[model samples]
Target chain A: MKLLRNLFVIIFLFAVFVPFGNAEEKRVRWKLAMTWGPTLHPFVDTVENMADMVETMSGGNFVIRIDASNIHKSPFGVFDMVKLGQYEMGHTASYYWKGKDMSFLPLTTMPFGMTTPEQYAWFYYGGGMELMQKAYEKNGMLSFPGGNTGNQMGGWFRKEINSLDDLKGLKMRIPGFAGQVLAKLGVTVTNIPPGELYTSLERGTIDALEWVGPGMDINMGFHKIAPYYYTGWHEPATELQFLVNKKAYDKLPEKYKEILKVAMKTAAYDMYIQNYHMSANAWSTMKEKYPNIKVKTFPDEVLNAMKTSYNELLSKYKKENALFKEIMESKEAYLKKARDWTYISDYLYLKSMSDTE
Target chain B: MKLLRNLFVIIFLFAVFVPFGNAEEKRVRWKLAMTWGPTLHPFVDTVENMADMVETMSGGNFVIRIDASNIHKSPFGVFDMVKLGQYEMGHTASYYWKGKDMSFLPLTTMPFGMTTPEQYAWFYYGGGMELMQKAYEKNGMLSFPGGNTGNQMGGWFRKEINSLDDLKGLKMRIPGFAGQVLAKLGVTVTNIPPGELYTSLERGTIDALEWVGPGMDINMGFHKIAPYYYTGWHEPATELQFLVNKKAYDKLPEKYKEILKVAMKTAAYDMYIQNYHMSANAWSTMKEKYPNIKVKTFPDEVLNAMKTSYNELLSKYKKENALFKEIMESKEAYLKKARDWTYISDYLYLKSMSDTE
Candidate 1:
């Protein structure tokens, strides 16, 4: 009876404490919500990639399940849900939360702001990341760069934008801050649902609309209806963001936390490259099929007017929010030095290549 | 006695089988050789970052010990060491092996190839990875992009290049294929050890030299002596490589393989951003301290001559190596469409901004 009792004690200790001692055996399950629908490429792919990496790196011990907007049924409410800890994290653009806080606007991108690589450098090495954390700390959430859309195209236009007069009273589906900037330029800016954008352009209900770059815009069939595609000035490096509930993040084991952070960072950079490839391919196909499609940049007069309005709006926001003022000032300072490097390196290189051609 | 014997058998099975069932308990140790010295910034940082991520993700079960050139005493010998399985892997550039094979040349960067983002897109999505693997299959190694140096400056010249005559018989310390192209244009190209480069340039042993971008070159004090800083035409996207022994990689557990790959990828992208930030800060400092530094682009007459010589050299190699031809053709095809996208997106945006300025 004594031998049997000793054997039973040994088995119990082995079954309970042995697994507990090994961190890899500790299982953690998490849920992530995304503002994008299930079918959105690159965005959905970014979430899936991050989750897969976390699961694999943890050896199946840590798993993240993603919920698309269709499943969550609250695309714009992602910020509130993640803040309330209803989900461990959420993937969405920071600009979407501008109504709740003006500081969230410039966190995404700005008109005539840093390009993709420039913005990435600012985020990782410049004071941008600290500023971002300061903006989110009050909400009990940590925010990170989710993914980048590279440089977005201006818009697809039915008529060529020749001058400032061309933009006056123009009916366009331009959203957010850009809409306000355009409105000040005498453009009739209006918001339209994504589904209605294509038909609106086709029927001349809206004379123009700005979507994403060629990658996401190709699917909307906007190029078919609108022959003029304008080059981008607004949203130069539109970065989506990941919002993490502070409590949930704090509870993760040290190793799991590193795993999750690495996974998110890798997935974010991968999405940028993935979208670059997609746009290159999509634009090539679009150009081959629609040879008449004209690529245009807004005339200097209109661009100058747009810039003035953008500055005026920025001044208004700066006066209203101190945090917004701090963030923009940091960005402007970084941009001055970073853009000089860009000019000598990538910009001049491209200019030289084009000159020879 | 029967009960005791059964107990012994159960304990033996539990101790042996439980650890085997848990993949996390499997230990992996790897040795990596780096072509760079220990003090090299961003390059050495990339290798350390990858190893650190792998160790953390594996919960310390997987470890990679890195030996830099100083410890290994063979900077250029990394390829052979990794290929022969003397080291499990190496961090080096593919173009260093151009002496043994011509196909290895373009794998790093070409004279007028794609920029950093474009090259990354090609590697991951535009069939460049497949071509790279095919190039290394015979060597019993696998190649992955280790990091990018972004766009390298043309060189620091003591005199501005105004015409084709300016380059004729100019003694420059430019190496590899770019040297051959310059040689064709009547330039006397020489190779000087890195430690001796600064003195050589200052003493006029070499009229000009290209090291890397401002991030790496600022430390070399070349700008202090040379006033003419030309924009990059060669090595637009210089990508370093991670060379892995196939047998060692194949021995890794499936989950470990994924972790290793994800770590390598994240580290590579991080290095590019890091270098960008470094260059931005370094250049800003250098410019302020030395306001006399002049940034110039080679004249059209000289650029056109370099292009002709570059094409001739490429044609010579293409005829000699079938693999080189195949790889270059694929790049040219991808560049045609990719450059179109780059022009309308980033290039035009930068151009417009500069025009306004």
Candidate 2:
């Protein structure tokens, strides 16, 4: 009888310990959807880097398979799909969903908004993250900064814009809130599909166009055709977004969760650096090989007009939505203080060096 | 007989799986020594953040204990301690080790170096990491950027500096390579203990002093005594470093290695943002409470002289050390290209906005 009792106790211990051990070794598979196609540099690279970190950090026990727009067949559907748990997570820009929710527009960027470092400060250290959570809470999704493209170029123009008269009646391939602001300035703003942008600009179907900065823009061959590459105005610091279904996120193990969060954060910052490198290299190549690609800033008259239109549009949105109002006010207040430090620090430093030159 | 055979098989399986599971579950404890004291905000917070991320990502299997300067009793001894494996890691500035090796100087920041974003691009993307690893390989240690204080304030001054003559025979409490450059320009440079800096400046023993920016300088209460706050010229992007014992790092489990790297990267970026937030808040507080503080830039004549002095010192070091020459040339070339982008992007944006204001 004692021998039998000992056998039973041993069996119970084995049953208890064996499953616990297996749990640690269990393999978890997740799927991610990205708004960009697989061919996009830095953007696609950011998603891949995050998954790589997650896999290596989790020892292959947790894996995330990414589906780009080519596979997913719906770039704009990412937020809804993640919300519905169709995919565990997504990489896309928040402003892309403005058609569904107008308040989601400014999360990506704002005209004359905070610069990259300033926006990052606001996101992580200021109340930007909390406000973002609040914005997405009702949608059953979680959002984080996926990556940044730094300051995007204003656009490619066949002719230089030296006055407000030069902007009026201009047909430009620009999109989103910036498009609206441009349209208000009498620009015949039209959205051309990405593949058609270069052809349209070349063929004069669109007189001007705005893509990303030189890093992503070099391939479009726009610099060869349009010599006037203006500095950015509409989007100062365009940050991409990472969307995760709250239910999917909640189901993750604590270790996996931390790994995912850290991986995402690091990957976001990495993309910014990577793009900086690409832009620098591309700019160097362009400057040496294509000397005609003139870099210009919109004259003060045109810029001030654009700013006025931007403010008016922002005011309209603020009046319509309380949350939008709150978010904008927060950004304005933070920018006022942060920009002062920026002016006294980086701005002055650059100014001093340039002055000497 | 059959039941006994089955029990033997089960016992063998348990032996194999249990050890494997335990290996993954094994707890790793590491000790880190920081150059800053426990009270240093954002700097100390950066170390804690990295450790916290490591713990959570490894599910408490990897833990790091941080010892501040107060506990370690040796602020400058961190590099040696980590090298000797007395501590597995350290948080300090790279320039602190210039006494041991002059090549270690520019890794922190040059007299007029890249800004935070520009320096980060050089570090992560533009071959800086490879060069750093090569430099530190002889010491059996690895280093990474721990945090950034962004552009430090040039210094606080009791009187304005309007010309090259203003700097002549001026006693200033400044340290490191910047002080070396300043001393060359006929300024009487002195290094005072941090606790006595305020008193020294108040008693006219020091005419000017450079500490960290508004984020850290607020605590020292220097603004009350020194009315002239000059913008940064030296140490544009002062990056603190994390030093790790290589053999100890190599021995870590693959999972822990990824966790540690990702944690360090995230924490480093976080510190930059956190400091940005702190500086913004502190500057606002200072401006509101202390209306007498005047922000100034050194006159063009003085700046030009300083630049000349800086170039001479750098050239002297470059001729002495091949690696230092290689690193500085690399920085100069990269900065030339990157600064063009910066001028067109953030600089123009700020210039336009300020013009309107």
Candidate 3:
């Protein structure tokens, strides 16, 4: 009986402490493939956080071994790597995969689809997530909102865009449906990486550019070269998405999946606040740091044109992209509900306050 | 000599096996006070992340021991605690400290103050931080944007507010300047701790409540009882702030202060995203899960009245509060920049887009 008791004690210790209890506990390794780098603050912040969250929650059962040392060439290959299971997960925006399916674009930004709050509402509850999941079905991934820029800065310009004619023949950096509208206005538009904007703008290679608001733009000092900083029309709300290969997501234990969702949500929300908070201070800093810079707005005629183009793009996407149609269908319903409340609540309240003075 | 060699050999083995490098790592620990609980999501997220960032940056020499578990109480207490050195650090908003000085309210929110992004720019770069710090000088605290909900939901209502008269005699839950404006509309407004709002609302304690936008209000399940969710005007550009004890912050090595600033910036941006992301889904969830809940907008007349009140409140604050004057002067310059951008950018962009095709 004494020998048996001693043996039992030894077995129990091994069961509880060794090999992390089971197959699940041993994964303290994260092998991540990247399309972007550490400078992509929001994405990097979230990915780094997720790795820590997963490790702490799993009690060393699972760990993400990020390949930060040699990040990938571009995000373009990240999807395939995630799908092929070279890494456990991947990060990038759904809109970046427009070539795979235009439906992904509506899941992202249009000319004026939804603000950060509205977009989150439409995607999470308005069946947008289901649609997003379905769209990614072909790619073998389930996606989440990884980062949000809240509302974006319109664009930076060398010359004041006081009229539609200002866009004519002037080279500007822009993208998505807004680029389509700019094309209509006869603007020479280009799509380039944000890192390259400084030299391009400095060399007079480009007349204007837009990037993720102040948190980043201020860091790069884009305002230094672009004296005419304008608002209204290019990009209103840009949401960054983190795409997980569906197979890997399915492989996640239910608990880890929950952790991932919570972590992603936390990261996404937090990034928006940081950008906003920084933007407020940076606005003042930019002026003091770069006195030559002028914060300008796009002209009335240009905005009108941009809005019309926004509708045109929406209609076009609805007709051509199944995902856009579904999203818009649900979005329109949600929007109406939101606007209904706005009319009486926000609209009425503001008007009343303004009139009181 | 042989004894010494043996000891060195043993020490080398210990160092090689246990991350026990020869270089001793010095660690400094400090307590942090916050207004919310550990499970408050965003704060937790920020703490978790900021901890990682600070530790890594400091080579693990600096560590923050969070006292969130016991520190959270009426937000009203956190600031004073910081000022009194009851805690080493803290997280709260400027508006919560209005009792300290009404001028401090401008550091948080003004009538139709800058939007989340714009406010961030102004605070960081627009010389707003220097002024804000000046406001905080008397409190033994320094402040910055810690978090933001972006543009908030107007409010929840028991009855429709269609005209200026409708607000008369209506009891409201408002704080800061917006509340004063509600008073101007002949409304018998009241203020209460947010934790107690549900009790007050359920007991028919207040005619209506203004908390946050749909993203937040829906979470509190306000729509379930209050069928009418009004939009716009209650608090247009409400922002959250971070209050750091002056002595504590001053004592922090400049490196620690930078971490605090970076952490706050990250949190502020993240908060904006959280509202939109969660609210996006929450809105649809409310509508779908609670189909009976109705969303409506305030009438134009009511909005006009609110705006009038907002302007009037602005003027009143300017006249009655020195801090208000300081903020208003700085804000006037910022708003002029914003207003000009609004005319050319947002206004025109909408117009142009509407006219296109």
Candidate 4:
């Protein structure tokens, strides 16, 4: 009887404790590829912040290591790598995949679409996440908002753009859809590597380039060369995306999954605020250091022409792709309601203050 | 020798597994009190969302139960309850505790202050959090951003306030420091419960009342009675706060602590976006249903007077409290930087689009 009692105790301990041991000992190590290079502030910071949060929350049981474009050697190839499970996850913008899937174009931002708060509202509560998931799931990947750059600057220009004529034959490095929009306006639009951009602008290989805003643009030394810094019109509220392989994500334990999701979200929001802070600091620095740098808005003629070109490009995509049309319509419908609120809320409030000040 | 080996196995098992069992089985249950009632949409939702995330992220081991004002019977007592450790946490606005500490007034919102994004940037990246911690730590509690109401509307008014004369002798229900500002302008400022607001406005007991913007005010039925909905100046970004007992927070395990903090952050941001969505939806509904509801901004004379009154009130607070003066100076400096970025980025972008559209 004594022997039997000891045996029963052994069985109970083994049954209860073995699973706990397994849970504790199991470690998840994930590699993430990034579109940006290692030195990109706020952008690189977002990925690192998410990874750090995951490690801390999961008590180092789940770790995500990030590889920038320099290490990966293919910045634009992140989506494909994540899709094929070459990297478990990737940090890039959804709009980068427009050539592969037209529906992905407006996921990042539209020319005159919703602002940051409105876009977030649309994503979380206004059926955007469903559409985003539907678009990504077909590629065997899940996508999430990685971060927001708030509103991007229009670009750094060597000369002020006064009219549509001023844009004619101008060599500018503007990427993706915005490039296409400017392309229709008789401008020479080119895409260059980030490292070569400063030299390209300085040597007059490119007369203008639109990188991110002051937070990011300050490090590139663009302000020294391009005195005419135009305000944003192309990618207002540019949101970066995190793409994860569906199989890899599905395999995570429930606790780890929740931790990863929450971390990514918190990191995304944090990046937006951080970028805002950085931009404020950078702008203040620029003003103090480069007093001659002029901030200008495009003339009415140029802005109107760009708008027409944007609408034309959008229409062509809408006719060519059903999902593109569906997504644009969803965004357009939401933007209408959301913008009305924005106008009444933030817009008017800011205007009132500005007028008084 | 065989008996000794069996005894050794039992000891090893006990050493490894007993602590694991205790860690897995020990559940921490906490109660949170809220100043708002259970039915408040995004406010209540923020608490529920935080609790839900905590439960999920902790794998049901850490749970938070929320008590609304109806149950807690102490809308204004949340600060004391959290400080005394009577509740593990409390969800309320920091401005509610202004009587206890003058510095708490500006933490929520100030007249003609930063908007949502600007305020959040200030809070997270511009040393607002450090200042907030300094204020709350003295009370034996920790405070975090609970949610933001976006840009609140000025008020629902029955008559147009074209000048200072129109505002004078006006019976209004604008609460907090804003009410004091209006009181200085000869307005009869009254405090009415949320339930009595519509009735009070309808019967001519109050001529104007500032509630939360369209999102929250929709359910209050204020728009039907008051045709003139004015844009906000006071309480431009009304941020709610979550208060945690310092001792209770210190006792949490590392993983649980991280989970709670992240969950709170995510919930706070989510609520802002959710409220934005709600406001957009409600505004659309209100416009369609109540076409007569005119969106107005106070004239320059009234706005200028209100601004002067607000500055005077702030000057008094600054003279009385050194911490209040310090916090106000910090906010003012950050706002100067952040608003410059805001004007160049979102403001310019929105203006450009509005002009073209």
Number of the predicted model whose lDDT against the real structure is largest: 1
Q: Which consecutive 10 residues in model 3 chain A have the weakest lDDT in total?
A: A339-348
Candidate 4 structure quality by residue, lDDT tens digits, A201-299: 999999999999999899999999999999999998899999999999998888778888999899999899999999999999998999999999998
The DockQ of each candidate is 0.69, 0.64, 0.13, 0.63
lDDT of 3 by residue, B77-195 (tens): 77777778777667666777667677777776665556554566567556788988888887777777766665566677777777788888988887666788778889888989778
Order of quality (lDDT): 1, 4, 2, 3
Better of 3 and 4 by lDDT: 4
What would the per-residue lDDT of candidate 3 be over residues A1-357, giving only the tens digit for each residue? 556555545654554454334333334454776567766665577677766655554444567766542466656777677778787677767777777677777666666545555566566555777887888877777777776776566777877877777778989888766677788778788988767889999998988877766656787767877887765455555777777767677776654564456556656665654555555446656767788876555566666777776677778878988766886787667665544333333334434434443
Native-referenced TM-scores of chain A, all candidate models: 0.97, 0.96, 0.86, 0.94
Worst 10 residues of 2 chain A by lDDT: A16-25
Candidate 1 CAPRI grade: medium
Residue range with the least summed lDDT across 10 consecutive positions in model 3 chain B: B17-26
Q: Which stretches of candidate 4 lie over 4 Å from their true place?
A: A1-17, A20-26, B2-6, B12-17, B21-26
What candidate 1 gets wrong by more than 4 Å, as runs, is: A3-7, B8-17
Quality class of the docking in candidate 2, CAPRI style: medium
Q: Which ranges of candidate 3 are over 4 A from the true structure?
A: A1-26, A59-61, A68-70, A192-196, A219-221, A310-317, A339-357, B1-357
Candidates' C-alpha lDDT: 0.93, 0.90, 0.65, 0.91
What is candidate 4's lDDT per residue for B43-142, written digit by digit as tens?
9999999999889877778999999999999999999999999999999999988988899999998989999888999999999999999999999999
- Could you list the CA RMSD of all candidates, in the order they appear? 1.6, 1.9, 9.4, 1.9
